[model samples]
Each structure stands twice: as C-alpha cells, then as structure tokens.
Target: MAHETDPVGDLTEAQAREELARLADLLDAANIAYHRDDAPKISDAEYDRLKRRNAEIEARFPALKRADSPSDTVGAAPAEGFAKVRHEIRMLSLSNVFEEEELVSFDQSVRRYLGLGADDPLAYTAEPKIDGLSLSLRYEKGALVQAATRGDGAVGENVTANARMIDDVPQRLNGAPEVIEVRGEVYMSHADFADLNARQTARGGKSFANPRNAAAGSLRQLDPEITRARPLRFFAYSWGALSEPLAETQSGAIKRLEALGFQTNPLTALCNGPDEMLAHYRRIEEQRATLGYDIDGVVYKVDDLEYQRRLGFRSTTPRWATAHKFPAELAWTRLEAIDIQVGRTGALSPVARLSPVTVGGVVVSNATLHNEDYIAGRDATGAPIRGGKDIRVGDWVQVYRAGDVIPKVADVDLDKRLEGAEPFDFPKTCPECGSDAIREAGDAVRRCSGGLVCPAQAVEKLKHFVSRAAFDIEGLGAKQVEQFYSDGWIKEPADIFTLAQRYGAGMQQLKNREGWGEKSAQKLFDAIDERRVIALERVIFSLGIRHVGEGVARLLARAYGSWDAFVAAVDAARDQGGEAWDGLIGIDGIGTVVATSLVSSFAQEAERASIDRLVRHLDIQEAERPRTEGSPVAGKTIVFTGTLERMTRAEAKAWAERLGAKVSGSVSARTDLLVAGPGAGSKESKARDLGVEILDEDGWFDLIEGA
Candidate 1:
C-alpha cells in the first residue's frame, strides 16, 4: 500500500491521524449536503478543491487511512428495506478526475505503471456513468444464479427474485463461460418514470423523488410480479470473479458480453489516449440533459486487461478506472409555507410548499418534511436537537431537482427565519378522526389509534382494497372509491361487492353525480361484476391488513391452501392469544409486527363482518392445480432459458407450475431440470457442470406431455 510520492509519509502518525480525521469530517459534511440533502453548499469547483486537498493528505498519510475513507467509496450504504447479501467478489469503486489535466495525469500514471514508453500507444474505454444503483449478477455456466446490490463494496443485498423480473437479464447465456460475474447499472428510463409518477399523483400517492429512487424502490419490491411490471433496464459494464478469464482487453470483454446477449451501453467508445478520452467525455457532456436517462458523469477504464492487472486496486477503488462526474444541478426558490399531512398508516408527514422553481428541467412546488422532529428544532422543552426537525412556516430552504422529476428541500437557512416566528406544534390527535395519536418507541412515525374509524385511514384502506396490485376491480379507481365511500354507497371493503345490490335503483342516478357519466357508471358496474371471483392471493392482499404485501399474501395463500382455513386460523390467532400468535411469528421471515397486524386486523367485529359480507357476494376461485403426478421434475427446481419455439416463456412457466414443478431463475446443485431453448447459453453449461438434467424445448414438451 506504500507509495513513493506520499506527502504524509514524512509526518508523525499522530499528525497524520489528525489530518485524516479532518478530511473525514469535511467529506462527510459534503456527502450529507450532496447525497442526502440534495442541496450542495459548495460549488463543484470548490468541492473539488477541498477533495483534492484531502486526497493529497491521504496520499501523504497512508498509514492513517481509515476503513471507510470517503476518497475510496463509490456510493452510500445499501438501502435498509432489502435483505443484505454478501458479494461473491468485492464491488470496488472507481477514482475520479474532473479536468483534462488530471485525465492526462491519470493516463501517464497508467502507462508508467505498465512500463510503457511515451511512444507506446495506450487505449481506454469510455462510457456514460449511469445515475443509478450498481449491481452484480453471477452466472455459473452462463445461467444467472445470484444478483446483489453494491452495498458497502464488501457486502450487498440479495435481490435474486426481483432481478429475475428484469427482461434484459437473460436467465441463461449463450457461448457460456464456466463461471462469470457481470456488473451493471439498474435504471428506469425517463419516459417510464414520468408515466409512473403521473399515475402516483393521480392516485393521491407520494411520487418518487427521482428516477433513481423509483428504480431502487421498484427493484427491491418483495413480489417478483411487481418488479416485472416496472420498466427497469440494465447495462453490463464490468466483471467480478470468473473461473476462466475473459478477453485480453476491456473492449473485447464488453464485445463478448454483447455476443452473449447482455445489453451493453452503446455509448461506449475506445480512446487511444487521454486527449481522446477527454474529447469523448466532452461530447457526452454536450448531450447530457437530453440523453433521456440520467448520466451523472463519464467513466473511463484502461482497455488492456494486462495493464489493469498491473495497476491493481486499493481496498475499495480500482486504480485503472475513474468517474468524471458532471457539474451539479442546483437552484434557489422561496419557501411559501409548510403543511402537515397524514398517511394511510397514520404517520404524520410535513410537506414544504414552495414558489415554483425549475431544477434539472422540472418545476417543483413541494418537498417532504420527513417527520415532526424535523420541524420544531427541539423537544417539548425547546432543548437542543439530536435528529431531524420539521420545517417552520417561513424558513428559507434550498431546493434541488434531478432527472426532471420531484424536487426536494436540501437545507433550511435558519438565520433567515421570519422575525417573531414561533415553532409549529404537531397535532396530538388524528386530524380526520380526532383519535389519540401515539409515536411508538423506536419508530419515527406517529400513528392514529382510531383504526377504521378515521376517515383518512378508512378511505386509504378502501383504495388499497381495490388497487391494481390487490383485487384489481378495474373500474373502481381511487377517486370513484372515495366518492362511493363518502356517499354511503360503500362503507367497507365488503360493501364494494354488494354495491349494485344495495343501490340497484340508485345505479342509474350515479350517472348524474359529479364526474360520473352514463358510460363511466356502466363501466364501473361491469368492472365490479367481473371481479366476483378472485384468486386466493389477491383476496389476501386486498384485505388491506398491515404488512400483508403481495409476497406475504402468496405465502399465506399457500400455507392455508383454502380461504376457509386461512380465515379460521386468523380468527383462532385472535381468540387464543400468545402461543397461537407466536406460532405465526415462528414462521421464518414473518416477524412479530406482521403477525400482530394480521391478528389485530381480523380481531375487530366490524372487519369480520365486512369479510363475511364480501365472501357472501364474491366467489373465491380455487388455487391452480399442482404439476402432474409421476413427473421426474415434480417438486424439483427448474430454470428456463432463451427463446422457446413451442410457447411464450410465460406460458411455458405456467404449464410447468401446473404440473407440480418448482421453477426458479438461477442454476444451483438443487436444480433438477434446465429447459433451455434455441439460444440457451450460460444456464445450459452451468447445468452440465452441476450434473443437472438439461432439456431442450422438445425434450421439455415430451416430458411434460408424457410423450
């Protein structure tokens, strides 16, 4: 780790430690303002100046280097919602150089490290640095086996189930390597994000802060089906551990990846020298904002594999590559006012009302308040703060918008607080229902105890019951549901099914109501009629119980097997406390909070009555039949790859499941069948290595059909 030009090499260990600590503090402050707050206090020029000074100090005092040094990191900590997955190979970050002089210096360093003279030409690859999450996908014999996020470089979250939903990520590869790891960026296209936010706003749901957050949220969803719905795309950029080496050059590796059916960024270009690299970066910078997807900067990597190996890497960053980030997008606006709102789950949220300002091309008027602690700046006694506080009535706040989407407040200038202004007091009761609100210990949210009695909570619950992810009563959109509830046409979820019956004569009158026409009213009625029969999983999720998301709903459906049995168990858990409920908590992955939510939701007399009435009007469909008997693949894990000639991939999967087979996306020792199609690549080879049975399309048809 030692270097000849280290500046801190001459300083004592104590002095080096002091300098390192100062660097950490400065970088941390910058990171909070830039990454978390979205408002950067310093200009890119000034920040780079400070960053270069720190780098010099770190280079001088290598002995005092900290494990989590800002200079060596790529991104912040992996988000909290997803389960952590340790990376098979560390996803080290890249260093950064902003100016052309630094780029030339970087090129010279690469040549010098490789023992190349000035006359010896050097080449590099340049690609747009995607403003998205970094991920690693592992393939054994060409079949995707594991996918993980770039957490702390050393560790990441296991998003294998969700990754399977990305269409670009082939389940199997062609012309497979024995073992390969592909690294890429996961992002949502600009158009898709816009559409998604539009739908969210129309439904009265909170829109995503930006494309990056939307992509992150969608990818981490528990349900594979939900992830599949999001328009997420991937662009393979690098590699990790491999059983056999790739091509001799970085450009060659990318070409090979493209041949293997990976989607590589078409913008990648090979540069002969630092000057060429700078030229390419400048070209990309000129078209940055109009590129459709967000690009924070350009990434440059040495083309020669040998040179990259020779340069090696630091603990968390490669010596062969660097990210040349674009300048920050910033703006200023007036803070008009602050408003507090409640959520479906009863959490009180503060929202900032602002004078319309454009950042990254989108006009923004509001920003999140996070919580009550962020507003008053003190506890009940006006003590000094420890955590975030709510924004006051007239505080000047910095705003930032990225990727032409939602704007967020970056920082508040308390010095500019209006004269004689008083700290805003948070409501102690639910605004809509007057119920006592409780801020649970260890939780940041304050929730209403009124449950179904609260109008806001009730309306939100009814909306969830008929949401697209739930029972999916097509014509029962959020606005329609709200109006129905307010008009007493629907009082509970069960009331939805009996609406036509209860208001048989009034149905004609609905056309006369505000926002309702004859065609719309008829469409609503037809939609309600169409959903009289629902699958078990949908019914479970549509119940609007807390923590019962799509994944949990499916798990419950499978475990209970029938609606009656599921209802019985839920009722039993409510009646016979402790052990009965603890048994639910004992199920791996189902925690106390979820178990309690389920039991509490069903325990209420009103909720039970609604369920009963709904069941009376609706027909609960039987679960799909399991895979056929005496089949060799029955109860065994199967992975399908490539394009199928006999049927669509979805159709093939449905047929397989109907016959009692357990299908998975990746190859493992447990895999019994690999039904590979025409272009079957990696998965087929991985199956060979694992000694799993490999079936061609005809062979699969023969086995399933008993031919």
Candidate 2:
C-alpha cells in the first residue's frame, strides 16, 4: 500500500525513525486517556489522522518499528483500581475501516490471505457495532461467577458485581455448558441517558457529554450498588473460554445466546459480499436514531466458525473480522460569541455560540469551549497547547458531530482569523447572582461562593430536587417549579411536602389565589402527597449536594442502609473528623471533595434545619442490598397480569421478586411464571401457549406464604 502524496516520503530513514518514535509515544498517551480515563484528549479524527501518519512511516521504514509502538497494542494497559483478571483467551480488538475503499481492501486482504479464487463464495455476518464499554462474563455450571472489562487485550479488571446489576445479563444459564464466557457491550439507552443528565442538571450535578461516556462511567462506578441503580443494559455478541462449542456459525451462536435469556442485536444480518455488507451498514446507519442505543459502525465477521479457526489471528485483531465505521461529519464555522452558563453547583461552563452550519445532516449552532484554560490554549499544567494557538471569536473553527448528538470543535484555522479579533475574557462574577467566582485548586471549573444565596444556584437545586429524575411529580414541571418559586408558594424542599397540609384546607387563600385554580391546585397537592414516601437513595439525591449524584447517592445509601444511619454518620463525622470522616470518604466512587461537601452541608445550621423539616414529613424506605448468590428464583423472568384477589398487582410483583425472581411486565418466550387472577387475559393465554407455569392467587399464596 502506498500514497502518491504521502508527506512522510520526503523524510530520510533516520528522520522517519525519530518521527515514528515521537508518534508512538503520542498515540500511546492518547490511547490511555481514551480507554482508561474515559476522557479523550483529542478528537477521533485527529487520533486517526496521527495513527495513519505513523502507519505510513512504518510502511516506508518497516525495519524501524519500535518495540513499544502503538501499532501492536489494541488498547492501553489496565488502570489501577480494581483487581485485574487475566483473560483465558486474548480479547483482541477489531481493525477499523473508515472508508469504503478501506472496507474493500479488508475484504480483498481476507480473500488473499485465504488463497480463495475470484468466484469463491464468501459469507459474513455484519453486526451493528455498539459504542459502549466491552464486558466479559464467565459462567460456571450455568451460573455467572465472574465478569471483567476489556482492559488491555490480555488482562481486564474484575467487575462481576457491577455486571450482575445489568438487567439484561443472565444471572444463571439453564440449558447449556458447564463453563463459558459471554462477551458483550454494556450500554445505556438514549432515553435513559437523557433522563439521567436531566436529573444531574436539575440537582446541579455535571451532565455527561454523551451516552457512551455515561454508560462507561456507570459501569466503572466504584460501588456495585451504584452500578445497579444505573440503567445499563448488555447485548451478547460473542463468547470466550467455552467448555463446549455453541454453534457452527457466528450468527447461530448469537441466536443460541438469545435463546439462553441474553439480549442480542436484531440488526445482525448475513451478507454474501462486500456490496451486501455495505448495504446492511447503510441500512443500519439510517435506522440508528430509531434504535435508541448508540452504534458507531458495523462489524463484519466470517460466518463460518470453521473458517475463522482456519483463518487464525493477528497480534491485536482477528484475521477474519473488520469494523467499518461511518465517517464523522465536519464543517468549518465562525465562532460568533462565548457565553458563560452557571450550573446548579455554580460551576462556570463556557459555551461557544457558532454561526449555524450543518454537519452529518444536523444543524449545529453551539459547541463546548470547556473552561478558561481550554479557551486560552493552556493545558491542566497551564502549558501552551492546542497547536500553540488560542481560540477566539471570529476565528474559523472546524466542528465534527459524533453519533449526531455531541458536536465538538475539532480544529482551528489560524489564517482565517479576523485582523482585530480579541481573546474572550471570562467573567469573574456570577451573571445571575453577582457572587465571587473562584477557581479551586486542582479543579477546572470556577465556582460561585454563594451557596443558597445565589438565585440561579438555588432554583437549579430546587428544580433538580423535583426534576423528573428526583421527586418527579406528575403535574409539576420546570415552568410550574419556577412559577411556584416566584410566588413564594414554596421556599425550600420541605415546603413542597407541607404545601397540601397548609393550603389544602384554605381554598379561599390557596386555591383561589392569583394564578391558582381549584382543580389544578388539588392535583398539585395530590401529586405532592403521592411522593411523600420515597426510597432512601431518592431523598439523598434530592438534597442537591455537590458531587453527590445519583450513583454516589446510591453508594452512600447502600453503605448506611437507612436514612437515620446516613444522617447519623454525617453528624458523627461533622465534629469528630477521624475514623468517621475517613469511613465516609472511604466509600468507593467518593473522594475528598464529596466527603467535605457532605460534612459542610450538615454543619450549616440552616441546611440542617431544612433537612430535619423535610425528614419529618417523608417516609423513606431503605434500599435493598444486592443478592447475586443463593436465590431460588434469582434469574427467572416472571410476570403477573390481570387483577389479583389476595393482593394488589404491585404487591404481587414485589412479593414474587422478594424471593429473587425478576418480575417482568409482559410475557415473553423467556418468562418462567405467570400469576393470574379472575381476569387473566392475553398474558395468561400466552403463558399457557408457551408452556409457562400458571399459578392462581390461592396457588401463589400457598407457594409464597408457606415458603
């Protein structure tokens, strides 16, 4: 392979070797930042361009391929934290095909490697490539015993507890081998990601830039209980360390896993040639948004298992498979202005308002500028970076869209800047509250000193507490939350719980007041009443404390078990900052920042009083501890449809699940039980037809109550 216009062709052998070494070190750092830290220092296009340059150099001088060259590495080495699990078989990565010609080359290379004639038949299964965290689950005697991440190809971090929390992951396989490892990607749905971010934003928490990062962050949570609270799902695509062969074909193996109670991608299809494979890829790309989950590309693997064995493997990727990724849409646009938006936690975020331009069919008008250092072209260490140039208004900036959701500034053209353009000066005071904005040490954000005093921060905190993710009332929304705040109907979170008690009986004053109606007011009170009882994690997160997002709140709730225990622990750690403080900070996923925030919030007399008032009006339930082992109905999918004679539908569902069975709403092929009552309908009929066991109300009581 050669390029007629390759830049590296001009360099001498010695110069080429030095440049290759430099590129090798640069790419290694990028891989670590991307794969381990869950943060990418550069755009995907920039990374690919650099890697391509290195490959060109390596091709020109094959003898000088460095021993530590990134070409031989699939991903960075595992970062320190969890225990490392060595893979029994290497979990190799897939070679990527960014363009149609490269995809054609991949097919040709595979055919050439196999010594196949031009007319020979070649079949492959093209699967939608999920943009998520790769996970490997090992099952022994049909029971999931351990799970690990795709850390480096040879070794991974143990994440069995976190993996078990995924609803799609089967806790135990009933119909198969004694030992097997199922390989899959754990991802979050677009809807779930939006909900989580909305809650985070409402509570003044940091929102995820994209769903891929959200899924990765959720899975890598320090506490498994936190992972359980996250809406993460898995889809089995391949396997490792199998005690017995699953199927003779790649597609057949996927079907087998689906039958074994595992979720599999339905877009997977059989392709006879590269044209057919590319057609399927295009079809998937068209339906990407409708699919809900994120997919970066399409993966083509040889259909026949025997052919894969014969084709063998490379050091980092398989010889029989390749991933064809869709190109990111990029366009050059002018930076019109920079705006500073204060978040609920008072962190200042710089947003770049851009001249409208379309990228990948979506019109993008704004992009993130990160922070002050990013705008000034300085790194975390304040060293001049970003090609030794700073971003300013009136400069021509290149932006790219990834998955059509996150649009980022990829590069800047220095020559296209206006003659009199000046750098953006970040504000030193909050725009909404006029408070002192100070940048804390080791932090990228500049925060406002005013806590509850800042209206922007306070309203954001209130919105977060009642946002769809927190106390989520039916009739309440952002508009109503702001309206109520403006009218002084609700001053604090506790005031919401007390609204009906104070206003319900006073129709002349409450319901008949300005902007209030009798029906709407009663509905609001009913909604408030409905939320008086909530789970412990919900209340903890509703407090709107900095760094205590949903995941960390679950970790705290699980550690303390109940609200009383959590409050007591914080109170104990407040004055006596020794073992108690250490214990609070020792919780996984929590650092010094979160611990200090908790203690400080409790120490505030006004904050403590507000919390006490809220606690008095609410009934908070303790979160259940995770039970991954020793449950009779643990992995079984169950459904209870129609009316129940002995108990309500919710009660039956909860009771059945208490014994360890997974309670599903609908009846499917995998359903293990159907509890029916007088009006047993389609679900019961479907269960009977599928041969699923059907138990009546009396029968269910006998089985559950007696046990």
Candidate 3:
C-alpha cells in the first residue's frame, strides 16, 4: 500500500485531513449530479482518480478518515419526485481496477481471504460493465411487481411504471420463483442516442450529453408513456433477493435469468482464473465501439455462489466483484480552426477542427467546443474551467477520447502555443444565413432568428424528418436529404411525399441523376410509399415541432388517439385558458414549457400549413391503447396503505395493475377506492372524508376474487 513517488503518499497528517474533507465534498456533489440529476460534472476517469487518492490518504492515516467518507457511500440519495423503495437486499457497488497488475493483486487478495494458494483454481464470471443507470426489478409469483433504482444502496426510487414500458423488461416470468429481485443496467444504444439527438435538435429540445445521460433521462421520466417511447434496453447481469437458489454459479444464474425471459449480456463468460478474466476484458475493449451500447469496463465476479457468500461485502462495495475500468486516453493535437455549425434548432455549435491525432486507437481530427462559455474557458454559471484558460485558433491542446464516441479538448498546452495566437472570438451572426443570432437570458446556445429561411436549419430539419425514429424512409439518409435539398427536388417534409407524383413520370428525371439509376430511384419511391402509412406517433414526430421528440409525440398521440383528433384539439386549444389548453398541459410529462412549444407549432400559420399538406399525403393510424375494456376497475385510481397481511405492497400494486386499475401512492379526492390494511393512518381518514370506497384486506380480496 506504499507509493514512494506519489504526491498523496507524501502528504502530511494535517494535509491529508484537509484533502480528505475537500475530496469528500467534491465526491458528494459529483454523486448527486450523476445519480440524481443524470448529469455528470466530471469525467469518470477524474472521479476514479479522486476516489483512489482519497483511499490512499485514508490508508496512510486511518484515524484521519472523516465521518462522511466517500468509501461509506454508494449512490446519492434518491431524488424527491418518486416514492422511496427500501431494498430488501442492499445493492452494493463493485471495487475498481484500472491496471492489469491491480486486477492481479485483487485476485491475490481474494485468494488470501479464502485461505487458498495462488496456484489454486478460482473461477470468475466476466461481463461488460454498462455505463448506464442501475435498476432492480422485483417479481412476485412469476409476475413483475416493482422496479427501483439504486439510490444510496439501501434505498431506491420506485420506477415500476417506467420499467414496465421497457420492452426488455418482462411483464411476467413463465417459470421462476415466488419472489426475486433481478438487478441490471438500463442503457441506450448508440444509434438510438444519435437519432434522439437529431429529433431533439429538430424540435429545439434539450439534448443529452451522451448515451448514458440519454438512457438515464429517458428511463427516469415521470410519464410511463415517455419511457415507452424511448428506445431503452436492459441487460440482466446479477440478482438480489431470491426466493430460492437461482444456480450454483454466477454464470449459471445469468443463464437462468435469460431462460426465464430476461436479456443477459451475450459476452458474459466464465473465466478459469484472473488471466482469462483479463483476456476477456481485452476482447471486450477491442469490440467496444462495435458493441452498439456503452460499457465503461468489465466486471468480474466470483463464479461460485457459495464463494461469493463467503467473500461477502465491505462497507459499500462487494468483496467478490471488481470492475476493470478502461484507462484514460489523451493525446496532444494542434487546433487548426474553430468552425460554427448551425443545428436544425438554429443553435450555433462550436467545433474544434484539430490536426489529426490518435487517442485510444481512433484518429480524431475534430472535437466539440460545446458553446461560447466553453470556448471562453468558463461554464454556464461563469465558473472557471481549465484554469480559465481560453482556447485560441492556433494553439497546442490536449484532446481526450476515453471510451467516448466524441473527442474533446481536455487541456491546453500553453508552453507549446504559437507566440502570436489570439483568443477565439465567437460569431454574433448566423454564419449560414446572415441572420441575427441572439443568445437569450439563461440560455446556453446562441440561436439564429432566420427560422426556416436559414438553409442549414431547413436542411437539417428535413434530414431529421426522415430519421430512423421519425418517418424512417430507407435510401433517404442525410446525404440524400442534402443532395435533394441542394438540387431543389425537396425543401420540406411534405415535398418528400410528393416526389413520386412530381418526378415519377417514366422515372427518367430521377434515374439519370448522380448516384441514382432506375433501380435506386424506384427503391427510393418505394421507401417513401412504404412510409406513407406510418403510425400517428411517427407522423407527429416527423413534423419536427419544437420540444416534441419521440417521447412527447407518443404522449400526444395517445392523448388524442388519431391525427384528426390531435389536429382538432390543437385548433381548439389555440385560445389560451381553454379546456383543451388545460388538458394538453395535464399530461404527466407535458409541462408548461413543452405544452407551450407544442401549441406554438400549431399556432404558426406557415408551420400549420406545412403540417396540413403533409397530412394530406399520408395515412396516419390511430394511437395504440392498452387493453382495459372488460376490466372491472379499469381507469379507477386505487390507493393501498398500512401493513398488509395478505401480500406485500409491491404484490398488491402489481395485482391491481394487472386488473387494469390505476394505483396511487396517496389518497386524494380523485381516488376512487382505498384499500386499508392493519395500520392505516391519514390516508384512511382522508379517504373517509372524501367518501371514497373503503376496502379492508379481506374485502379487497373478495372484490377481485373471480376477476
């Protein structure tokens, strides 16, 4: 545990104490931002470095370990929106290893703890450690009962409704125990993330930083409909509370979960020893980008369930498992120029064009500058960054791409900078359309006021309209959209639907075009024809209305049921303070901002004309609805309170939902029924005062006996 050349190792007792306190505050803030807000202020490498330094200091001076030490915490406390769920079995984290030697030492420590020789055989299961939100799904009697997030290890947030919306999460298990809590990571694929960002930009919505943030934000949405619209997926890798033994080994348990209708990682393999584990880690890292999803590292766990039990856990992390994190990759590069790209939303995005340099194998020649504040070496709040060193056009900068698809400037090499280098001056006007680019108060982006007149914004919006999550016309990608736009073949979404009608006279016009022959032109026409009968949600999303991404589109679609109904509602809602306006804002995920944006899209004369013309050429289907027609309690809100003698709260809620009943956490005037248990309190009194139907445990069971 000694490091002769380390700065932390050289710290005095007093210095170590002060450093620990500072590190404690920094780590606490980072955890809250990452876990609660779904926004990380620092990189994973930086967080790991700080944690390692704190641990080293704590080891050097044990007595100096502060009461609020980072080692004692797992995730941050659950945010206030959702009801708290106390985990039956604590969801412990895993220790980390960033080097092969450290992984070897970890194996040695496990062997020493188990009283085994280094030569003795030890099996471990290695799988990709997903860079996403941790969730625990509880099943009761072969039915999915509840889902919770990993909040502060011992407690979590109830996300049962959102979990049910995820396609990967099985609603019911065919053959499983009476009770089981399956743990896994909820992640978004790279393609989905890109598509989501495209839709966000098209609609002038807030875009996520990365796939991890996108997945977290999508899955944690208040409305289940929003979560359902998101392309969120899960990979079951571990388990918590189990009614019976799943399997004798870790790999076997994963297979069992897969067999019982769960998606487990395909790369999860049983390694004979640490060498094999590290080999698997290397293999996984090599195929990282190609894997489609985000994985920060490889997790290795004791294969034998009995061995894991014997090894047990430390304060917050498990002793039997370790995460082999990918090393941070950085490289020095020259800043050739700073280019400003206008997005579909008219946001002026700054791009740093760098001299080609390889960071972590891939050759990176461009990196994101984020916004004006970032280029000026300050954050949104005017906080200093990179020691407040502003970037210049011609300067030596350090670029980092550690496992991220996007490369970014991490630091500036001041010593290597050119003598005459000057600070970058961000543009005040739209570079594409010569429009007034204004930065509104409290907004991070400077946007073009030219609206649809801006060619860049118009072309980008057209591209997004045909994106995978939108209209999804095959052979009509970004390149085709750009080509068609430049050639004046298509200028808007409605123009795409009429391409065949306007230019399909013998197909000669399109066939003779560059990159197009008779077959290719015909294929494009067929693709457009195929997309003419899209679903209502897809049609709504294709419009690229502000703040209306796939999630909002789905919510709006479900609320109105059909395109005509949706249009009618929008027309009726034109008058402020009307019932239609109130109803639009009443949707769970449709806040004031989103509702206002949606209404504005319809209010604008030009936008409404474009939408009407588009609707004329397409067959928009009715929104899909859940099957609740014949259920007795369909649409009735019910509340359960106190200690139930017959079933757990999760079981009761699941049962009620299965019967098509809506379950609420508290008893309000809107509550139709209240199921009171032995220790019912304020809720029961409120229910009585409201004259809502009351049912005891036996009465509730009797009411739903034959349902």
Q: Candidates 1 and 3: which is better by lDDT?
A: 3
Off by over 4 Å in 3: 1-6, 330-707
**Predictions in order: lDDT:** 0.76, 0.82, 0.86
Q: What would the per-residue lDDT of candidate 3 be over residues 398-452, giving only the tens digit for each residue? A: 7878765689888886876798888888999999999999998988999998878
Ranking by TM-score: 3, 2, 1
User: Using alpha carbons, what is the TM-score of model 2?
Assistant: 0.50
Strongest candidate by lDDT: 3
Q: Candidate 3: minimum summed lDDT over ten consecutive residues — where?
A: 1-10
Worst 10 residues of 1 by lDDT: 1-10
Ranking by lDDT: 3, 2, 1
lDDT of 2 by residue, 465-560 (tens): 898658998777777778878878777888888777776785556677666788888888888888999999899998989888977787788778
* Top candidate, metric TM-score: 3
RMSD of each: 21.3, 24.6, 21.2
For candidate 2, which ten residues in a row score worst on lDDT?
Answer: 1-10
Give the total clashing residue pairs for model 3.
0
**Per-residue lDDT of 413 in model 1:** 63
Pairs that collide in candidate 3 are none
